[model samples]
Target: MRPPLAAVLGIDVGLLQSGMGGVAGAELACAVSNAGAAGCAGGYKLVGAPLSAMLDRLGTGTDRPVGINLIPEVVGAEELDHQLTQVLDETPPHVYVSLFGMPDDKVFDRVADAGRHLVVQVGTVEDGVRAAGLGAVVVAQGIEAGGHLLGTARRDELVAALRAELPDACIAASGGIGSPEEAARAVAAGADGVLLGTAFVVAHESRAHERFKALVTAAGESDTVITDVYEIGWPGRRHRVLATAVTADPDQPKKFIGKTVVEGKPYLVPRFSAAVPTEATTGRIEEMALYCGLSCSAIPAETSAADVVAGFAGVLPGSPAVTN
Candidate 1:
């Protein structure tokens, strides 16, 4: 009685971890996958050597099926094509690609042609149907999700709508889902599985900044806000983040507030940049964009990714309770 997505992805449970940039790295993804759930590494604008190295690490880290998240809006067509090509060529057949926004038909065709699985996270029923029509496992993302939002629908509503439209499609719910009870609610609303971002942000293996983890663990239900203020790198997309001083008044001075290193390269993080604070970041970390979701209330402290996966495994349909 396992969820359809679990069977499709060859995992024991239907739970999937978000490919949170800066936070979800090889360690976190491997930990989650090892715990009988699906895990995905964030591929935020990564290309060339960095992307290749990441895929190599993931391939060697765990034999379990893992995913690489790529956003279509972040990179141009040429770079995205390169990323997809590298992913399909360099990784084994078990590795799949997950996209944040609706990709063109060519992207879908490329993955199908390569015989690799593709998962698309969409924010609307129409997008879900389209993705499903193109032979992708659909992940319906609500506005409550962290990072860049896809649409303005609520988690349950979108899940139900997608289910009604595509009865046989593998639909996973994302956003505002932290606790096992909340995951159950999503299932009750017709989701075959649940995808979590905020809960994984506080995982012990996450690469998020220590202060950022602490702030998320201490956040309340009402401490999150959806804003488009931090849009320097990836613009025009709204994201849910913790209520910070910068968010309170977004008109602050446009100066470099921090620095982060990704794949051996260093980049200066300017004020209102969409970069999340990672362990490699140094500067006014407090003023940077701290992406968080309403599910922060369920993240009490940093724990192992296995425990986070175990907590949600039991809530999935027909999945046995997993122990960390």
Candidate 2:
């Protein structure tokens, strides 16, 4: 039998790929889903045509379950509604919606009304209970998570707490989980599954820039630090990233450091921007926000997304072999 979380997600494995902005695009998402694990594409600040195009590609890429991640803190309510609307219209029923933070009742109701599955990543047990009550699967995010800091709790501890509070809920653990051993440890700690970001960041199908993948693969235990320096685009939020010269000094002059093309639209990346380096980004890549977790220490090289998922199948309880 599949694990509770995996069954809830309609996947063969309990492992989930994080919807990392600029990294987890359609190719990566399809690769993971084809491997029998749940996959997600980052829906960061995308609206209208770009969002619709991506959704269309994801809908056609794989028949397995997939999700689109949206951060409520990054986009306004009106924009989020628009994004959600387009997502519902453009994708099939199998494409679920995932939220990084706790969304308001209206947002939860919207997804529920559409009879679609909702996954909400939360930093606290209270939020997990609330999300479960709202009929959504809950992802317990720990402090070790890369990109954005959801809470200060440790991964195992948070998962344990959520389990204690809601025994029947489909709870997954996120943060600092890079290897098969770590995934097993999370399950031992009461998580129904594990969600990994750093491990997939180096996947060949990931859209992360080559330089970013190189840095993550070469990173050590102490290479990452949590800070708010790279918060121009999404300010006041702390995130864990590889220590760069820009992070070393927060007062550096704000300037355009790079350029990136998203959904065929080019945009200049300013210094301290929250934008991650992708294949479409160029110029001073190392100085930008290089989101990484302690899990980077385990990701030794770039590999296919299918291989990444296969690595964890053995460790995840009830996880089946990858069909691909």
What's the count of clashing pairs in each model shown? 0, 0
Q: Which parts of model 2 have CA positions greater than 4 angstroms off?
A: 1-3, 321-324
Cα lDDT computed for each candidate against the true fold: 0.88, 0.89
- Give per-model CA RMSD: 2.1, 2.2
Q: Which candidate tops lDDT?
A: 2
Backbone clash total, candidate 1: 0
lDDT of 1 by residue, 71-188 (tens): 8888977788999989998998878899989878999999999988899999998999999999999999988787789999999999999889888888999998989899989988
Cα lDDT tens digits, model 2, 242-289, are: 999998988999999899999999999999999999999999999999
